[model samples]
Target: MATTKLTLSVDPEVIAKARRISKLRKTSVSAMFSRYIATLEESKQRETPLPPMTKRALALAAGTAPVPENWDYRDELKDILDERYGLK
Candidate 1:
């Protein structure tokens, strides 16, 4: 892969933590950041479902919820019309 050089800024505390971890693992801080970014990207690419919400949290959001039994989001837009101007 072609690599590009870039600069980034991070908190001093975070840099200190990364430096400690690198020292323990005998790796460079750049490698640690690269691995961290790669792991995050891999997780994003896998399309993993988000963690489940607590029942209390669910109940709180349900106050304004739109979903009812046997609701279909795809068909909800079929009868709606939108007009756009000055494009294309």
Candidate 2:
């Protein structure tokens, strides 16, 4: 791909730090900025899909579990709270 030069105004201290880091990494400052910009562009794309474990859990929960008849979660939660907190 063709590349275009971009002129940016940055703080002298920030440029100095970037120069030091790039020198230590044995890469040009422009190359470092290119990599950083590429990373930002990649992140702007769609996020990664859910992991395998999460996908499997969701699939198993979707109409696969047997729920007991007349099961009220509110009553169950109240009972649990009463037992734990000694509330009437």
Best by TM-score: 2
Tens digit of per-residue lDDT, candidate 2, span 1-88: 6778989999999999999999999998988999998999999785889999999999989987677899999999999999999896
Q: Which ten residues in a row have the lowest lDDT in candidate 1?
A: 79-88
Question: Model 2, 45: alpha-carbon shift in Å?
Answer: 1.9
Q: RMSD to the native, candidate 2?
A: 9.9
* Model 2 weakest lDDT span, ten residues long: 59-68
Residue 84 of model 1, lDDT score: 35
Quote the positional error of residue 27 for candidate 2 in Å: 1.0
Q: Residue 75 of model 1: what lDDT?
A: 57
Itemize residue pairs with steric clashes in candidate 1.
Answer: none
Question: What lDDT tens digits, residue by residue, belong to model 1 across residues 7-87?
Answer: 889899988998999999999888888899999999889986555676567768887957788987765654343223323
